[model samples]
Target: MQIGITMFATDYAIPPQELAVEAEQRGYESLWFPEHSHIPTSRRSPWPGGPDLPKWYYDTYDPFLALSAAAVVTKTIRLGTGVCLVVQRDPIYCAKEVATLDRLSDGRFLFGIGGGWNAEEMEDHGTVFATRFKLMRERIEAMKEIWARSKPKYAGDLVKFDEMMQWPKPVQKPHPPIIVGGGFPHGARRAIAYSDGWMPIGGRGGDTLAMLPPFRQLLKEAGRPESEVPITIFGVGMDGDALKRARDAGVSRVVFGVPPEARDKVLPLLDKGAALMRDA
Candidate 1:
């Protein structure tokens, strides 16, 4: 089981570069940063976690910029967005950013994305909340074209672009490992459809073990071998039985959540988590 850390890159927390270096030195395999382009004050959408949303949601730094900083400070450790809001951004620009980052990081980039849940936030991006999933799919498809082809063109209900030339193709052949982030079975189906992997958050009320059979079936249905898709659990806390269960369910990676605290306070826990995961 590969161990990694995920944190909200907020202005008040330890800088991303320092956190990345610490994790890399301590034998962590990767560092994941969450994204929230900007939190709207309208409060139209209830917080998914609870009734009240956390303040950090509004203060978080751009995941791409934060991960880029992390990438430069560490070698061998992969950098990724824990769950980038692909439903909110222009796919063409996102493709460029992702490819550039992958090249700069020596192909150590995992693109984890999701159709976010914030309704008003989606509206702010001019994306319909009802069709957000469809938009995300087409956006990812469009981005793949930009990444894999010399002169790419995409025309669909959501994304339509003429043939355009873009340079600095990703160092990873055919682009980076796109890890679809969400709970099953809808997210699992989407992952099988277009992503290289599935990143499901722990404790999302999903039958983690049972999820695999259907997920594998979906992969097979999509004409992709079951072995081709990796399952990674995000925000996993230290629990021996749970880890065993996840491994038994064929989870390939486990990302522990790092508290938004000072470096000294958080780094030790991260180190302990990494050590335990490695031993597990």
Candidate 2:
């Protein structure tokens, strides 16, 4: 299984470019930065991870910009948006950004996306809470059309655009791999429907290892092969046994979270993770 690292990419953390270079030198396969345009101060929606939202969530830099910095600095490590909230973004501009980054990275880009949880946050972006899922789907479809066609037009209920001309198409044919992030059945179903991969948070509902068989069965039910929608679990711990278990379960990738911190603090953890990856 491929091992990767993800960070919130805050102003105070080891900068994304430095981290990307370091991760690549250490033999990590990919480097991911998560997106959160802005966190609302209302605190109306509960965080799934815990009661209080972490400070880094409020301070994260734009994932595309951060990953662009990473892309320019590293040649081999694949860059990814850990979970870009497409529901909150304009698909046209987003398609341009994705294509630019993919071109800059020479086809080494992974598009990890999701329908985010923050209701007030989505509302601030002119997206409704209850229907955000549908909106996300439409936006993704629209982006796909933009990437695949020179003068693409899309007319979905939530997202619509006339045959717009855009340049710098993505280097990856049919665009970069779209990896949907969320918990199973719903998330897995969405991935099977539109995306190329599934990424569930580790320790969210139950063991991700336990969900593998059922997810594959769901893929079969949808007439999609397991190879078409590989699994990538995020927030994995640095445990050799767990890594082996994930590899045994046929997981394509496992991403470990690096806290937003200084280089002195983060490098040791990366070193430890690299050692574990060697053993894994």
Candidate 3:
């Protein structure tokens, strides 16, 4: 199993490049960053994690920019968007960002994505909350065309475009791995339908271990090999037994969350995580 770290890059936190170098030196396999363009102050959409939404959601930097900074400074450690909100973005520009980042990182980009939960935030981007998942599927389909073909054209219910050329195709064979992030049957079905992998938060919906068998069964029912659609559990804290269970259960990767803080506050946590990685 692979071990990784994730943080919300913010104005006051440890700089992303510096954190990337630290993670790489400590032997972490990948680094992830989450994105939020702007939080709607209306507080209409309750945060899934808790009653009080953290400040990072409102203050986080763009994932592409933060990951790009990480990519240039690290040679081996992979860079990823923990979950880029594709539903709120234009596919053309988003595709270019993914491709450019992959090229810059020498094919080390992992595109973790999701249809986000903030209804008011999506409304600001002119996306209807109810149809966001459908829109996400179409946008990702359109982006895949942009990455793979010389002159890509897409005609879908929500997204339509004429044949047009985009530069800087991804360094990965067709494109970087698109890892769909969410929970249970719906997220797994989406992964089987289009994405390369599935990422479920460790304790959000249910215990990841409890969900693994059914997830694999769903993959089998869809005729997808278990190896093809790997499972990545995010926000797995430093639990040796849990790590062992995840590895034994055939989890492809486990990512631990790093609090958005200064170097002094973050490095010790990385040290503890690194030690856990060694043990796992």
Candidate 4:
């Protein structure tokens, strides 16, 4: 399994470019940045992670811009959007950003996407809260059409557009891998239906290791091979047993969540993770 790192990419953290270079130098396979356009201070919707959302969620720099900085600074480490909320953005503009980033990074982009959790946040973007899942699927489908065709158009219940042309087509043939993110079964099913990869938060419901076989079974039942739709589990802890279990479960990648902190604080963790990678 490929081991990597993910961070919130806040203004106070080790900047994305510096972290990318350091991660590459430490033999980390990839560097992932999470995105949240804006955090509403209303505190109406409960945070999925906990009672209080971290300040980094509101302070995050735009993932595309941060990853662009990372791309210019580093050559080998793969770039990723840990969980870009596609439901909250305009797909036409996002398609352009994805294509441009993929081109600039020389086909090194991994598009990890989600429907998001904050109801008020989605509402602020003019997206319906209850129907966000369908909207996300449609947006993803529309973006694929945009990436694959010279004059592309999509007519979905939620997302529709006339035939249009966009430049700087992604270097990755059909566009960057769309790694769908959500909870089990539903998210996994969406991945099988349309996305190129599956990204589930580890321990969201229970043990992530225990869930993979059932996920694979679901793929088999759908006539889709799990191998074709790779799994990348997020929030994996750095440990021998966890790593072993993740590998045994056939995970394509496991990303360790890092705190948005200074270089002095973050680099030591990267060193330890790289050491574990070597030991594993």
Measured by lDDT, the strongest candidate is: 3
lDDT tens digits, residues 214-247, model 4? 8899889989887789999887767877887788
Q: After superposition, how far is residue 64 of candidate 1 from its true place, in Å?
A: 0.6
Each prediction's TM-score against the native? 0.96, 0.99, 0.99, 0.98
| lDDT of every model, 2 decimals | 0.87, 0.92, 0.93, 0.90
lDDT of 1 at 165: 92
**Scored by Cα lDDT, where does model 1 land?**
0.87
Candidate 2 per-residue lDDT over residues 1-280, each given as its tens digit: 8999998898899999999999999999999988888888999999999998998898999999999999998899999999999998889999999999999999999999999999999999999999999999999999999999989999989888788899889999999999999998899889999999999998897878898889998998999988889899997778888888998889999999889999999999999999989998
True-structure RMSD for candidate 4: 0.9
Worst 10 residues of 2 by lDDT: 235-244
**Alpha-carbon RMSD, each predicted model:** 1.4, 0.7, 0.7, 0.9
Candidate 1 Cα outliers beyond 4 Å, as residue runs: none
What's the TM for model 3?
Answer: 0.99
Among residues 3 or more apart in sequence or in different chains, the pairs in candidate 1 whose N, CA or C atoms overlap within 3 Å are none
lDDT of 1 by residue, 1-280 (tens): 6778998888788999999998888888889998888888888887756788888888889999999998888889999998999999999899999999998899999999999988988898899999999999999999999988989999999899999999789999898999999878888888888888998888775566677787888788789986678888898787767777877777888888877778888877876886677667
Alpha carbon lDDT of residue 182, candidate 2?
94
